[model samples]
Target chain A: MKKLINKPDDVIREQLEGMQAAHADLLKVNYEPFYITRAGGPVKGKVALVSGGGSGHEPMHGGFVGHGMLHAACPGEVFTSPTPDQMHEAAKAADGGAGVLNIVKNYTGDVMNFEMAAELAMADGIKVQNIVIDDDIAVKDSLYTAGRRGVGSTVLIEKICGAASEKGYDLEKLSALCRTLNQNGRSMGMALTSCITPGNGEPSFEIGDDEMEIGIGIHGEPGIKRDKIKSVDEITEMMTVSIIEDKPYTRKLKEWDFGKNEWVERELTDEPLKKGDKVIAFVNSMGGTPVSELYGVYRKMAQITDKFGLKIVRNLIGPYITSLEMQGCSITLMKVDDEMIKLWDAPVYTPGLKWGK
Target chain B: MLKKDHVLSWINRCYEVLEENRQYLTKLDTAIGDADHGNNMHRGFKKVHIQFETLQDKDIGAILKSVAMTLISSVGGASGPLYGTFFLQMGTKAGSKEELSPKEVAQIWRAGLEGVKMRGKAEPGDKTMVDVLTPVVESLERDVEAGKSLVEAIDQAVEAAEKGVQDTIPLIARKGRASYLGERSKGHQDPGATSSKLILQALRDSLS
Candidate 1:
């Protein structure tokens, strides 16, 4: 492929090195082969958070490495998984007095590699707990295949979980919270333009200029439907309505007591959700979508959230996670309790992600 | 035909095939699935190639195991685990053996299919590699029952696999990421089935 790279084999290495050089204040380059975290890693007494996957989706595990996110991110070759050895080393490096928590996506390779790495680390006296992210709602049958692929909501999960860990939640508690996040969150993405792999040189797939696919997975996998491009409002309604109906978030709100200071059992209803309840809103770009478009989506999301009266305690807007250079975005909303809201506001700093601390 | 070198050559050939098709596979995946299938298989096969080089004097089982480990590590999508588990199960059946009888080969194929079933949790109508593999394995059994030698059975298996791959074009995917497309998946040949056919073809080519 004709791109600005020294060699096809060295693209990930070169890109990571460049990322390190450009963001020196926020990043650190690990030695060759096992490029895990070394900058803004977990403190001596804090629990470590490590996550990674293929290299094409930038600002994910790597960029999110800083104060409030991952302790280290093991970047594999473009769209490939990092070997178990790399994950093992990252776990060791990030492990402070508290154990290390590995945030793995639900892809088979990622799951197996991370599982093997956890086994290897345990054999080496390292305590590694793993939480797999499977928040995408594009797929319905988790019983059949490997389940839904982790998508944009993974960034929000990491941020919230990191906040929990920062608040001195033990490994078990953090792991539990991670599972809760997975259960409570849902995402759906779409694509307009296909992305070009660094070495492949050409677009991964041919998309007509006028058409769009909805219910697409993050990796540019075919979507549920290929049809005429719809307006932003139509797309938003399709995604949000499906997810909301699937999860029945509006009905779940009735089960919670807003001011009585306790969760109360109630019937599921379609009533407008009340304010004062905590929520996290994420407008994530799918690789190539610009910030301007994402903001438009965020504005739409804000309008929708307003109708529900869901308090937007936290709003994350950016390409925190991506699908190479595919053109689209997914919106994720996580209803939070008071404790989660506090953690969401905690400060932390890392390469591409930074807040509170 | 069907010598020990034949299987080794087939594995090595698969590495080559994956290397060559990496971009195309990833490109196809970018359209309807995660954009990493090409890179994942390429990485897995590259690792297998390295392990093959390192374990030159080892048995076929060792070689297959090495390949399996490599694929499991390097490939990051569904194909990685399914293909890796396929080799791993094959290796488990023929552990450290320098060669296999026709029966042994058939058994290995069955075991490999079982492993794939266990890992992917897919069935024939799901429009998965199973759609290709199930028929091939059955064809292998049928050929062996008809008094065919190992080479003959493998030949029939490859033919069945090719047919199965072609058949995926009309069927809707009901498993894996592609299954999410429902009826839209029709018309395009299943990529996993295509690669699966290629792999079986490699084996047949090496056998003959």
Candidate 2:
């Protein structure tokens, strides 16, 4: 609540304005249904990747929009899903005639809005498809609840799928690859502190100085349980082990069925992380946690991987995806084959992530 | 009979009620879900209020449809799509008529529930907005069929909605972010359901 800001109402617009001014070289901003697209956009003949969600998780959908990452990102109010109009406009802006792929998270609101946008985009004669990322292992229900909330793996999917699209994969191919990446990825996160969304101007959930949320979702959704705050190694061990040993997540998800040109139910089961898996180990700070703390997390993560006989071939440590000023970290372990590693290495440029241009 | 003026009054009262209870709604949500229900509802209604001039001249169906569009675009959370679909379905049944008989009013509520069911995939015990809305519609229809006046039917709807709101306090959530809390979500009132009751109360007041 003490953070610098003029007013809660102006939070998102002002942030976007600052982002637009600073990153004008790589991105272009639009309002009245806020969205951002790559400045040199409509990368002709390649599939366009559009992703969006609530705004508190920054350097995510928006910051990733650039040369070789997301083509466009639709931003809603803090912790609120964007309306369909923004998604539809983003699709139109990013469309290069090859078709568009919407990378949507698995939260109920986000899924519904993205699905509506896909239908609208298709009606306008732009071929549209979508992949829902529900890689978080925190939420235990697949048969009942709204399904597991999408979290850390979202960043991985954007990078890999963005590379595939930039490499001239068509909409169909890119979407297929996205599903593959999502299937191979599983994540678990913990929160040492709660994030305060600007609009609410209050911590999402109150926790004591001695407690922590063990399996928190990105939006500050309640996790498995709260307990006395443990050492970093202990926290890291619990999250990493849960992701590695999680059962095959069974759930029904909707996808844009190309053959029928309509949304259809697709059952997806995430394959568990296995021993001897070659993986890209990602230790991401949840905005408020410092990079130095992330290194501490990675140090413990590497130890855990070694004990499990899983090889950490490559690693990403930073705040690539974050909950606004929330002091926590989420670990994503993606079982990577040559194709995925190749795509992960192919990223070019973006405000939040950049390398291998 | 539910007239066009009644519909306009309902919308106006809805805006006022949400604005009045915005902070309370947010505080309720802070305990179990993201604390934005009040903020979202107020923002959605504020848009409808701004465009009320243009919407007033349209038939009830068109007016409700415009409200749906404004809400779907303005409200940012799960409520945006849920409430937007509620009004959209009501608009379809109410059509272009300036007024409605009791049977027509029941039809509008029926279609609205169907839309909520389809959009949220919620059931009676899910501790969602459906808990309040589904019962309100059922009570409204039953009272109308039992030879009640328009005011009597709305009174029944409001009573059922209030009861439904009370019912949500003990149930475990099976949908949305609240479900993430498991048994801990039991004590907190469902913010969405509480707001739904407010909406029904507004409808009843407008009819009187």
Candidate 3:
């Protein structure tokens, strides 16, 4: 309950205002229906990419909004999905006549709101497509559950898809690439401490000092299993093995059918990782976990990947996505082709991610 | 007959009921889902209560539509769109009607239930609000067909809804955040179903 803030109600707005002030050159915030778009407006002829989810996962949908990344981000209340109107307005503001793509996480609220936004945007004569990301390996069954939660892989999809859009990929092509990125990536997370959402003013879950939660989503919900805390290497191995040994995941996903002019369900399966596959190994901190601890995770991660015969072609290590101040880290291993590797290397400038500008 | 005044009263009652149950609902959600359901519902209804000033003179349809818009924009979770769609569909069915017969009430609620089903894609056993809503809609339709009074039909619907909520306690969740826990999602009553029961109870209270 102890943290820096005025009132719980003002947390999202105040943080957004601070973000606007600090990153004025990179992005602009619209408060009424709340969304963040690139500072200079839409990039003409490029398919605009928009993503959003709950607020506590900072530097995610918001921080990734800038050149060669997300064109806009709609932030919701802490651990809550943004309304459809926010996404509708953002699509209208960010559309450059090349259509808009909504990158939605696999959460129920996030998916439903984005679907409504797509419907609204389409009625307004704007072409819209939604690609849902469900890369978390934690959820074991898709048939009986709500499916896997989207986690660390979302950051990678945004970066690669952003680059593809910058290269003049059409809306349909960008959607396809985004789907491919989701299929090729898998992530698993564990938490040492639970996050305290500002609205609740209490930890989302109580974990004993000696215990940890594995298979956690970004929203601070309790994960699939809680176990006693283990060494960095052992924990890293546990998570990495879950990802590497995960079976091919199949699930029904909703997609906008431009020709049919309606939403349709499509069954998609993610191929399992195998030997000699090239990957971009991402070691991401949940929030309170320091980079030093993440490196400790990456060291073990690198050894494990090597031992498993998976080649680490490139890597990203930091807190790009977070759950308030939860102390944990997630590992994302994304299979990359030459095109994907090249796109990952492309120039990107944003408040949360900047390089090769 | 169900009048516009009754609809308004039901909405106002919902605000008070949700306020009283906020902490209780949050505790339920904390067990199987993220602990925000109570706060999310309370915030949405609080905004809807404010719109009463503007909705006072409107017909039942208009009032319900306004409430839907408020909840959709303010609620900010799976419940937001689900509940928003419920009200919106009711509004659509009740369009331009200041009062409705008991049969008409049944039809409107049926429409709302279908809208929720379409929006959330949840079946009756999914351990969602749909579980509570479906039985209530069925009870209302059956009671109205049997020539029951508005109060009698609603009373039966409330009973059906209560039973539906209880039924969720032993079932595994197959939708929303609770589904993420798999078997662990069992044992707790669903937060969505619980809120849905409160909504139906408010309707019955308003009629009385």
Candidate 3, which segments miss by more than 4 Å at Cα? Answer: none
Q: For candidate 3 chain A, which ten residues in a row score worst on lDDT? A: A215-224
Q: Which has the higher lDDT value, candidate number 1 or candidate number 3?
A: 3
Q: Interface root-mean-square deviation for each candidate?
A: 3.3, 0.9, 1.0
Tens digits of lDDT, candidate 3, B1-208: 9998999999999999999999999999988899999999999999998877999999999999999999999898898899999999999999999999999999999999999999999999999999999999999999999999999989988889989999999999999999988788889999999999999889888988
**Whole-model lDDT per candidate:** 0.74, 0.89, 0.93
Could you tell me which 10 consecutive residues in candidate 3 chain B have the lowest summed lDDT?
Answer: B177-186
**Cα lDDT tens digits for candidate 2, A1-357:** 788788989988999999999999999999888999999878888999999999988899899999778999999999999999999999999999999999999888888888878988999999999899988888888766788888888998899888998888988788888998888888888898988877877888888989999889888888888999989989999988888889888888899877887778998878787788999999999999999999998998899889998998888899877888889999999998988888889856999998977
Candidate 2 lDDT by residue in tens digits, B1-208: 8999999999999999999999999999998888899999999999999998898789999988999999999997789889999999999889999999998998898998899899888999999999998898899889889989988888878888889999999998889888888888898899999999988788877877
Considering only chain B, report the TM-score of model 1.
Answer: 0.92
lDDT per residue as tens, model 1, A65-105: 77777778899876666777688888887888788888888
lDDT of 1: 0.74
- Docking class of predicted structure 3: medium
TM-score, predicted candidate 1 vs. hidden true structure: 0.85
Please report how far candidate 3 places residue A352 from its true position, in Å.
Answer: 0.5
